[model samples]
Target chain A: MKELTILSGKGGAGKTSVAASIASVAQNAVLCDDDVDAADLHLIFKPEVKEVHRFEGGQVAVIDEEKCTNCGICWSYCRFDAIHTKAGSGFYINAYQCEGCRLCERVCPSKAIHSYRNNNNYWFVSDSRFGPFVHAKMGAGEDNSGKLVATVRQKAREIATETNAEFIINDGPPGIGCPAISSISGVDAVLLVVEPTRSGLHDAQRLVSLTNSFNVPVYGFINKYDINLQVSETIEAFLNKNHIPLLGRWNFDVNIVKAMLEKMSVVEFAPEGETAREVKKVWEQLKSLMLTD
Target chain B: MKTLITSTTSTPEGPFDKRFGRAAWFCVLDEKTGESTFIKNENAEGQSGIGTKTAEKVVELGVGKVISGDFGPKAKKLLDKFGVQMVIINEDLKVIDIINRIKG
Candidate 1:
């Protein structure tokens, strides 16, 4: 199956909206939201969760007060300063500052320290209107979002392969950080959702170079291209210089937000609308490119 | 007793590496003989877990003490488990300088 990720280096670049609409057109595709930190695609798909799996991001050390010996070995050895003393309770581990390395647990001479896994993160397999969907939720200030992205993508791939689906489309996270890298890695192609703003072009440039480094073929569409005609021209010029294919130039429409409020993808929300037609064309272009191989 | 010092190069005169896990080389010094040997860190440029991997290697090398600019939390934990002493020296000294000072 062909795997494609929708990415924009900058946030609010319409990655989720564009990806979700494209999923409606790519009817045989398995869809996944790789942005675990602040996932939004589920709002459009309205998935019914089939499986829920907890993710242990890392281990946090805990001190047992019953052991009674106020030994300071754990306190001294804690590189993260996670171990702190309370007035009557003695030492306690600060879950926030804890790096979850379990150093203090190993160093405690009295064996008062033990480690526990942080299970605040979870991934899900679900049935959406678009097909099997995989997504995740990360706890606030949780570590290992990158690993969680991998897990979500893995589940999506397994489901796609099992169902013999034609495509695996991911709504990727913003920026060139860990989660973004995890989202794009080993994917057959990347669909860049570029917004026509100076900052949008700037961030898309970074994302473009990153895709280049990963050697992933990139196809793009300018979301809200009419919002800034001059910047759109510049962005188009840049994409042309880099030899990245431009599939469609879309207009800025309030219908996107209206479609979300109605809990529908653009294609489903407005079947005969201009945006839906363009998105369908985008999907057709993407399918020809990915299926050509 | 043997002590390990993180270094930027595989030479006694090379600048000491401030970072522990990403150091280019580690200089192992035999305190009794005042002899030092350099071992390149193969996992220096690796992504994630290199600190713990390097710590495991140091424990396998059977060093009594380790000196570096800083230690990652995971590395510090693993080394402490094996009773490997960690010494953080923030000074910009050469590997030979650390060896002489520690030997003395």
Candidate 2:
């Protein structure tokens, strides 16, 4: 099966909206939202969760005050200051500050520090109108996002093989961090969503270089290309210089916002509009490219 | 009193007079000769606020005391296990300079 991942260099670049649009047009596709951090595709897909699984990122150290020795040993050894004495009584690990290394628990002479796996993350396999979607929800301020992304991808692959889907369209997270890196690996192609702004170009370049490192074929779609025509031209030129395909360019339209409010992809919300048509052409090209391979 | 500067690398002589995590770096300077082995850190990278396996390494290196920008719970426990005294500093300062300031 061919995998088409939609990615942006930074947030608010309309990656999800475009991915949702592609899913609407693509048939027999397994959709996965690899944006484990700040995932919002569910808001649009309105998926009904079929299965839920817990994600264990790591362990957090907890201090038991009842053990009675406030010797300050943990206070002096802690690198993260996760352990602190509360007004001269006992120590505690600030969950936010704790990295869950469990060193304190091992070193505690009084056996006061207890390290345990923190179940702050969860992943879901859901049934959406487009197809079966693999997505996840990370607790606020929780880490281990890279692992979660891998889980989502694995589930998507499983479901796709089970259903004999021809494609897997992934909505990837922004930046060159762990989740983004996970999304780009072993994928058939990547659809980079670019916005026409100074920072947009800068971030797009970073994402392109990262994708280049993987030797993956990449295509670009300039979202809101009309906002800054000069920048849009620069983006097109950069794509040419780098030999990355420019799928299509979209104009600034409030109908996208309206479509989102109505819980529909832009293509489905405004089937005949210019923005929808551009997205459709891009989808068709991507589908053909996948078929050719 | 021997002071150990540490990094996350499981090796000695790692570069960087200070590390990125663990409150920037530590500076434990001597008051007498002013001669100090600057223990710069190159690989002290990991999750924050857990424990300090690296800090345990610092204590094992014969550091009598630690003067650092910050100390996490796990590192602090190991330091205590080895009877290492630590003076936590609030400001981010030069390692050697901060050690000198503490000595004074």
Candidate 3:
């Protein structure tokens, strides 16, 4: 099956907006939203979960106050400073601070420190209007996001295989971090969704460098291109210089936010509008490219 | 007393691992004498792909224990598999002093 990952270098660059729009137009497609940390695609997709699975990303160390001695061993031993005393009574592991290293747990003479598999993260396979959606939720102040990304992708792959779908479209996370890397690796092509701004251009550069390093085929699209005509021009030129395919440019349109408010993809809400037209063109291009390749 | 300083960043002065995004440095020190040796992390492995594969390399550094800035669940799991000690560093502090303090 051919896979196309929709990625943005920074957040709030309309990556999900574009993904959802394109998803509405695709046939025989499985949508995988890999932004497990701050998953907002559900806000639009309104998925009905068909499966829920535990994701064991790592462990978090905690101290048992009842176990007697507060000899301060764990406090001093923690390199991440995850241990802190609350009300001077006993030590507590700051969930956000804890990296689940288990050092303090091992050194405690009183055997107070204990490590447990954190259950703060979870993944799901749900039925959306578009089809099966593979997604997840990582608890606030949690680690192991990259693992969660991998989990959702694996689920998406499975669903695609079972349903014999021809395509898997992933809405990837922002940044060049573990989650982003997880989404891009081994994908057939990367559909990079870039916004028109100075920082957007810079982040796009970094993301391009990251993708090229992996030797992945990349296609570029500029969201809200009309807002900064000059920068959009620059982005097109940059993509051309990198020899990446320019799928098309989408102009700034409030109908997108309106579509969200109506709980519908822009393509579904205004099938003949400018945004919908561009999205359809992009989808057709991807479909033909996959067929040819 | 033995102490370990770990970072996700890899550097030539210390161990260099590409798997980590600047969180791949681990410097083990002798708490009593203040002498330290670098683990030479050939790859700063994150919790994905070959980066996840480097957990064994990190275990080979022979640290009696470690204090680190951040570690993912996979790395923590591998560390458990190798029986390496781990301490979580929640705040930004002097890496050396934290190591010495943990050794005591």
Candidate 4:
């Protein structure tokens, strides 16, 4: 199967919109939203969850006060400064400050401190209008975003193989951080969407560097290229310098927003529109390029 | 009794380093003998766990006090357990100036 990912180093650069549009056009595909931090592609796909699984994050240490010994070893050994004394209360762990290293629990002389896994994260396997979908939602301040993303992708690959799907398309998270790295690992190709703002160009440069370092093939396109044509040209020059192929550019259009509000991909809402036509053409070209390779 | 001061360089003339973890030098001052020695900080450029490393060094050296601009939560916790005193100096000054102030 051909595995493709949609990523933009900068947020609000149409990664989701482009991924959703491609999802509508691709046949025999399984979709995964690797943005567990804020998985929103499912909003457009509206997946009916077929399977649900809990994701266990890092371990957090908790101390029991009734154990009768205030040896302070746990307090001394806590590298995160998670242990705090509250007036009358002897000690408590500040969940926010804790890195879940489990050092405190091990150093506790009274065996009062015990570490527990953070299981407040969940991932889903479901069916949407476009195809089979895999996505996840993690609690605030929960660690292990990269691991969660890997889990979702693994499940997506399983469903893709079982159904004999031709493509596994993923909507990746923003920035060249952990989640983004996890999304593109071992993928066949990456679709990089860039906006035409100064900040957009700057972040896109970072993403391009990251992708190239991983030696992953990248196909780029500019979203809202008409808003800043000068920036668009500069982006084009940059992509040319980097030897990354520019697939196509989409004009700044409000119809994308209108289509989203109507809960439809641009392809589904306005298949005959100029933006939709360009997207269709790009997907076809991208698919052919993958097949030939 | 010994005190540790975060410094920018391994010399008395160098300025004090406000950050404890990334300091380039650690100055150990003997209150009784009025002798000071500077030690290079190997963890100055470390990306993570610098606080823990610095604090562990302070504990191993058996310093009674630490003077720096700020201390991270992790370093502070370890130092507090070891019963080491902490002093924060926000003003930009030379290492010599701080040593003089301690002597005065």
User: Which candidate number maximizes DockQ?
Assistant: 3
In model 3, the runs with Cα more than 4 Å from the true position are B1-104
- Candidate 4 TM-score, true structure as reference: 0.72
At residue B51, give the lDDT of candidate 2.
32
Q: Tell me candidate 1's interface RMSD.
A: 14.5
lDDT of 2 by residue, A106-154 (tens): 7789998888777878899999999998888878887645456656876
Candidate 1 yields a Cα-based lDDT of 0.82
DockQ of each: 0.02, 0.01, 0.07, 0.01
TM-score of 3: 0.74
Which stretches of candidate 2 lie above 4 Å from their native place? Answer: B1-104
Which digits, one per residue and each the tens of the lDDT, describe model 1 over residues A1-293? 77888998777888888988999988788998987767899988989999999887767777888983887888888888787899885778888899877778777778888888778888899998889999888788875455566667767866876898878999998778666766765576789989999999999899887777554679878989899999999999999999999999779888898998998888888889999999988888888887774
* Residue B23 error, candidate 2, Å: 36
Model 1 stretches astray by more than 4 angstroms: A68-81, B1-104
Report the number of clashing residue pairs per model.
Answer: 0, 22, 28, 0
Error of 4 at B85 (Å): 53
Q: Write the per-residue lDDT of candidate 4 for residues A66-104, one digit (tens) a residue.
A: 882776777888887889886875788888888888888
| Model 3 lDDT per residue over A1-293, tens place | 77789998888889989999988999889999997668888888999998898777678887777994878888898999788888957778897788877888888998877888778678888999998998888777765456566567767866887899988999998788778877765566789888999999999999998887554578999999999999999999999999989998788899999999998899999889999999999989988876665
